[model samples]
Target: MNGRSRARALGVLPGPLPTGPLNAITDVAGVLVGHTTIDDGADLHTGVTAIVPATVRALPAAVHTGNGYGKLVGSTQVDELGVLESPIVLTGTLSVFRAADAVLTYLMGLHPGELSFNPLVGETNDGFLSDIRRRPITERHVLDALEGAHGGLPAEGCVGAGTGTTALGYKAGIGTSSRRLDAGGGPVTVGALVQANFGGTLTVRGVPMPVEELVPGAGRVEPPGNSCVIVVATDAPLDARQLGRLARRAIFAMGRVGASYSHGSGDYAIAFSTADPAPALPDAVLSPVFAAVMDAVEEALLNSLFMATTTTGVEGHTSHAVPYDRL
Candidate 1:
């Protein structure tokens, strides 16, 4: 009976725009999400999450860094080339190298005899909750996550790369939400997936949450400056530049959710589209896309808090989920 529900399901934080069928990032056609959780021991509370774009190959993309306080592997190339060469991976901070190498290895197996591939991997410091020094993640976990990726309702909170993450003094993890736009041409979908590990005031529907009162000893946990990795996907046929613009709106949404934009926070948004060769939308129509992203991101961040359950890790340090009664 420890099941947790989404925010909208309880009416605590309904987003502005109408959601796609699933209301999750997978609602974007062909986009897939998968995770490999590794919480084997008191100290090993970490894993990997993978997002595989529809193209099954390189796709036009962009990366926007709200704060450059992270070890984002293979980002410079994405910024320069404006194209994502591999499926994006998320994991712990210290394990970024392994995650990147694993992504590259998987791509190699798919396109054998192909060399020099760039892998995009994002991470946050799960060290506070898990024994990060052990580096529990492995290349196999990344491949498993990638191979298992699929489109549909995604499993969020306390899973995958979010397994050991804490946010706003709560046990925040993976959260995803999607918004659909009916802009005369056709219905376009924009989805956001987030690793919620940073710190903030924790707001829902414009009201600030009292994390300290909600959780026992919540005030003892550290404050902002950890990190958050937001992966956005759309079917709008946007190019690298437009995707970068769409990515930036995610930070605004983060602020809305109570992020302090602290120096230690590595806030990044990686956005791309499945419809390649489909031209980028005119700037005139891009405003709605930006709006959609902000709405979806805010809702997604709340979902992370609502869906996650209390978790106890190394040294008996427990990250309590926002108490259900408070909502």
Candidate 2:
């Protein structure tokens, strides 16, 4: 079960922009998010998350690599073809290959006789709190996540692929937020989902917080080679190039929340559009979409921390959630 309020509920991350009814990625019509969490007595902690876009079919998509230190299958195909042939899956770094294979199998089952399909899978290291050596995440977890995909708010923080993730020295996990923007053409919705495992100084708005002072043993125990995976979805019509630009803006949202962007961090973002309007929205109007990306990304990151509960795994190593009172 979720433990605390999201950042907006605490009045620390609200902006002028409004959120959709569920204030989640699902707010972008036809998008669904699901999770499969694995928690074995103190040693194995890892799982899979699946994001289904547009429900019934593939959609136009784009990807941006802020830091290329991790594995992300099918990114090249998505970039080359400007299409997303499969649902997006997120899991631990080492589980990416298996997860991709599982995703392909799952999709193939959905469309039997489909011989070839590019599986989009993203990952971040969760070894710090998980017995990653066990390779506990299996095809079953992938199938479960895909089968259980739902169109309401997703389970965030310490769930699914975020089960064992640690970020900004806190027990961070799955986080999501969405924004509603008016492009003069009509109202467009931009939503963000983040698997937070990267390290960084923690900040709120423009104020950098002394993380170690707030959470004991924060900076000392977090491992190196951390990573973060951001996924953005929108109802606005945008081609692959425009979507790539939107992906970059999602990274800017990381800076807003004080990401360290360290050498070993694998920071990547993927963006997709549910709409395919002719000519697309005018480039001049993309500013609202960009701003929406930044807003949703920042708030989602905060929610990853705010909603997370303390975790203890492998050898009694503990990753504590940020104390709610500090806010």
Candidate 3:
């Protein structure tokens, strides 16, 4: 939607399900997304991404950790209480804590008398391209992302938290996709956003990408451990337990995109529902939603790679973008 070519435009459809109007996480009613990219000419290529639901109050949510190698602040509480009380923020690994603090600062202003709160923040290592050790992210950057969130198509690739990220040896950043389901009792939309920075052979649909042929000598420059953070949103009435199941489906979708889920890869998925309080859907009707999650996630992961531009950062490390023409 932002003028950049996405997976669908390239005939790389991940599934048969129809997408929402915008084909983004924002397609879920009441969901909003925003980003604050910090791209200094060189050395610093990092920033923040914020996902906010309609209300500030706690919403039904769940988290799934495929590999617990990275930090995901406030995940325990969400797993225990089955709810999220703050906007979800994503950023570079080292900046996670600072981002959480910023979320707390912003939420405190919204609820004056609230004595306690849990801020959800996730991260992926971007040290390969960004000067992550410097921790360039500030409270202002995080605040800007939260305050600027809107309901519509969000910018993808080389932006926000994805600025310096890479996936499967290709430059990748933020990517998003959505699906509309009509079989789960009624029409509902499911959407996913990903900060892809992991390792493995790139795969599209089911075919492995010819990375070596397309980008001669392209190889991993980062250290062993990398990470990916996925955020899934739906407008269906699902309880925390059900959302947990949905989150797992999102994690599984990574395999469809050739994610190795390596020893050091901290892969995580956080799923939440925007539907108002109501009776949860029966287990028999959840299959369609699960399928939608996998499809949306696969497409989102591909979008992260395809939409990204080649970037050079940190010392002399360069990550090449996937050659769309070759694919």
lDDT leader: 3
**What lDDT, from 0 to 1, does candidate 1 have?**
0.86
Error of 1 at 238 (Å): 1.2
Per residue, candidate 3 scores C-alpha lDDT tens digits across 64-139 of 9999999999999999999988999999999999999999999999999989989999999999888889998999
Error at 50, model 2, angstroms: 0.6
Clashing pairs in 2: none
- Of the candidates numbered 2 and 3, which has the greater lDDT value? 3
> Which prediction has more favorable TM-score, 1 or 2?
2
Decoy 1 TM-score against native: 0.96
In angstroms, the error of model 2 at 13 is 2.6
Give Cα-based local distance difference scores for all models.
0.86, 0.87, 0.91
Task: Please rank every candidate by lDDT, starting with the best.
Answer: 3, 2, 1
- Model 2: residues with Cα > 4 Å off, grouped in runs: 216-219
Task: Flag regions of model 1 displaced more than 4 Å.
Answer: 223-225
Clashing pairs in 1: 225-264
Please give each candidate's TM-score.
Answer: 0.96, 0.97, 0.97
Winner by lDDT between candidate 2 and candidate 1 = 2
Best by TM-score: 3
- Estimate, for each residue in 1-327, the C-alpha lDDT of model 1 and write its tens digit: 248989888786455689999999999988899999998658888899999876656688889999999988989999999888889999998888989989988989888888688889999998878888888888999999999999888789988999889887788889999999864377799999999888777887778886887665666365333899999998887888889899999888898888877889899999888876366677788888898999999988888878888888888888888877785
